[model samples]
Target: MKRTALSAAILLATSPALADTPNTDDAQTLETVQVTASRIAQTVDETLASVTIIDREEIERLQPQQFTDLLEGRAGIETSQNSAFGKTSSVYTRGTSSDHTLLLIDGVRMGSATTGGASWQFLPPEEIERVEIVRGPRTSIYGSDAIGGVVQVFTREGRKGPPKVDAFVGGGSFNTWETGVGVAGGTENTNYSLSVSHFETDGINVQDGVGDEDRDGYDNTSLATKVSHRLDNGIEVFGSILYSEGESEFDSTEGDDYTDYVHAAIRAGLRLRLTDRWDTELSVSHSRDENDRYTDGSFASQYDTKRDSVDWLNEIFLTDHLLLTAGLDAREDRIDVDDPGFLGAEEYAETSRYNVGGFGILQADLGRHLLEGSLRYDDNEQFGSKTTGQMAWGIQVAEAWRLRASYGTAFKAPTFNELYHPDIGFFRGNPDLDPEESETFELGARYSVEPGYLDVSIFETRVDNLIAGFAPPENVEEARIRGLEIEGGYERGQWLSRASLTLLDAEDRETGNELPRRSPVTARFDLDRQFQRFSAGGSVIAKSRSYNDRNNDIRLSGYGLVNLRASYQIAPEWQLQASVKNVFDKDYETALGYNQPGRAAFVKLRYQQR
Candidate 1:
């Protein structure tokens, strides 16, 4: 599970007050934002979608070592983890299922076709440049897996300056250690960047009362590179690659097990300005998510999934205030699974499939009012054909106030494994499963001033044909989720503060039971202060109780955690940092029967060329 970004709607969601000082790419202004909400790079004052942006500066300021550290406890986001180390991680946006949310890297979708989710743990934070989180349904623009929202990660790229180098080394509890280095430089016509990182930790036990009690360990190494050049004819060509591989150990009911994983993304593209009013971009991408399982020191199973895709996008400007956009996306997903002899002699019915979708969007701005609409049609080899659409309206009701409303329809097709995997001893595929469909309605209000901002959003979503987890999974469930989000921030000179709160009512329509692993209430607060050469900050994250099972027979206790951090400037290009997590050592569980890390501490040394 994983990612999303900034815009008015963002201040309260991402709470940049708690993130870091604003960089060029993440200005705290309504006239700024590169949001995925519309794929048009609209200003915050113009977009209707709720967005959150976290840039490199914030990523470094937070000193995160895991994907959860980057997004956990934020407004509209609920995350569950099996261990403190790199084990199984899940992120549910607006109470949607794990597979309902889509993960993208530089506009390219990346995840496992078999599981329909990303291997978030293997994505090294050091390779990322920024993250954008968009909440709400986007099936009209992204095809499937957008019923909940989209998480897009922008990898680090070269900056226009002399050669620059950034590096860090750190260590903490659980016998953990990490280090990374990056170099970037660019000229008027060309740019390039490369980065590398490594992390290892003696993780905690995952199966508390089950078969394996040994401490599970994790190790990961990653690399990222990017290059681009501008031609005299005003055409731009670029390429980027991100690769990460790691090993994770965990506990299962059967016994102790380990997994080797490799997750990667590759992209190449061309941007062209064909005419005075027309612009277009053509790109191709590849993504891979592979996992090999070993039980009792022997290979037991393997899942290798790959995705290849191409996109052709175009934009036309008819008037100063009106724009039209169109695009075509074609993708193929292929999966290979090996259970050795456990799956008998039957092979998968369909190991590969392809999908093609075309979409168009129109936007108009009339002074104080904004209107937008989009429609898409998609054809899948297995699911046949489908159509989706959305409409959004916004207006500046007052000089300092803005309001918006939107309604959208979305859908998600079953993964290959869910529909075609051969019958095995423990699991079976449901060839008759139907695609999940959903619709959502949302309303929002925002208030902003020079030094502070506030925003609120309320939404209701209904999903049908929800998949059940029984053996031979079936689409025999329904769900309803209604929620409210409030976020606000204030910055006065050296003091920066922000807070967010979420109230959710997610339940199964059939049983009227609370959705599993979804807390009804969650909140976060962050405060930071800066001195001439020193800085300090702390955060508090709290969540209400939730159910661990659909029947409501299991309860997960609510808990709160406090974390503190401090940093000192050692020189113009060097700094030292120290931090503590779970300051009070609170005993909590985001997932049932999983051990969580206790009070832990870390120290880091950093260097950057200015």
Candidate 2:
């Protein structure tokens, strides 16, 4: 019955009348520009990789309260959070470990070298203009940490229009409050945008059974700015920055734990069009992640990481049907740790590593056929030299159908703490650990009609020399993950709907046990209706059971959630919005022993200049 209903909806969406309608803000267009998939601008239909793009318009429509909220139900993704908002969260892509995925902001890598993951809790949605998720190994484009996939977040950019200002204020469950303001505009050759936001909440008790019943609170402030100027000679210069600082409270077995964190990044680039067929870009960036943890109101430890990188990219059009791309990247990573009491002052507190890589890509688009190949070589100070590559091909089987296949290899470098942290009896770091590596293969098909599209893919990834906890990290684990993903969307007239489902089989090859924290199945559905100045929508997310331990000892039950949202345009420059999450108040957990948020409600007022 479910499948029947879904098919019927798609049929209706592709009807003659609906199929002729122009693509609107609510619709997904095949001509949408995407860059992250190949590190160059190309239409969605021209790219061979499986990709998803959430634009600014959709961001405003969804109004996700946290970073994880924006990613939870996406295809090939599983998010695990320790507790409510502002808590530690991790994203596993394609049934891979949390650290296997790479995070980028405006093409600059953003994450901590010590933790081996980005602080998703502090990335405010207001500072983002779009998110591009490329589902497949992209080591040929990104040197390391691309085993599962890559997620690149583009910062807000100026539009080609008169100067305008937008503002919003809101309040929600758990005594939460949010506010943001931005100004943007552009001329024929210049563009600029700036934004600032703040959010705070008296969150729920993260530790329900540990006798600490106080409300764990969180607060954050974020700022973002971007500017670009183009010359008549086909040259462009651009710069951007994003900064955020926040504090969050969490539960710890030893003491009351809280953290203050600051994350910042600055990027600048120059683009040159030497000729009609040749173009190049020179870019540089610096990013930092700093965290100070407190126990019982006293500073307990500090960890800070900084990264500086430079890249030179060149693209050449060999012919109307062929293109070539090549690039060189150099990066330096530095870490500073101050954990006097935790490490006893004897372990190495500071470390640095450098890496340089060169990559090349060739693409050919013949009639009804598309082919792509990429290769990369990286020399790392700690891991020596490694090579990775990928090959993909697609064939247009029919006017509205396509078939695609791909094979790729990727790797993840050891983190600072994973390589050098002191051995304090319970936990330690090993200096001899090798980088983890994986190979992935996938087959996919897509069908596109006038106002809708459907995509399905099946993939298998085998990882070797996987890192595992053994006081000092050791390459004593192996994993084989296989999965299927189905996603579809339709938009016509005043209605839009999207749905996705994922089935996963992830196992530890050594013990034949299910990999920890990976759900066997997950699904999502969203539907919305727009009428004149008002809109209403809702979404549902469901997940299957998963284990919290590698041995499959601690089980986490499966659950479902429903969320509803609505917005009304009060005037040409003013609007109102509201949302209710966890409509049924279903009790569930993404991790063992952690209490998730129950029912929640929120309301907001928005203003904009026309």
TM-score for every candidate vs. truth? 0.94, 0.94
Tell me how many residue pairs clash in candidate 2. 0
- In angstroms, the error of model 2 at 339 is 1.0
> Ten-residue segment with the worst summed lDDT in candidate 2?
11-20
Compared with the true structure, all predictions reach lDDT values of 0.82, 0.84
Candidate 2 displacement at residue 137 in angstroms: 0.3
lDDT of 2 at 593: 85
- Structure candidate 1, residue pairs in collision: 3-151, 4-132, 4-133, 5-52, 5-53, 5-132, 5-133, 6-52, 6-53
lDDT of 1 by residue, 440-497 (tens): 9999998866577787899999999998874889888999999998877777888877
Under the 3 Å rule for N, CA and C atoms, how many clashes does model 1 have?
9
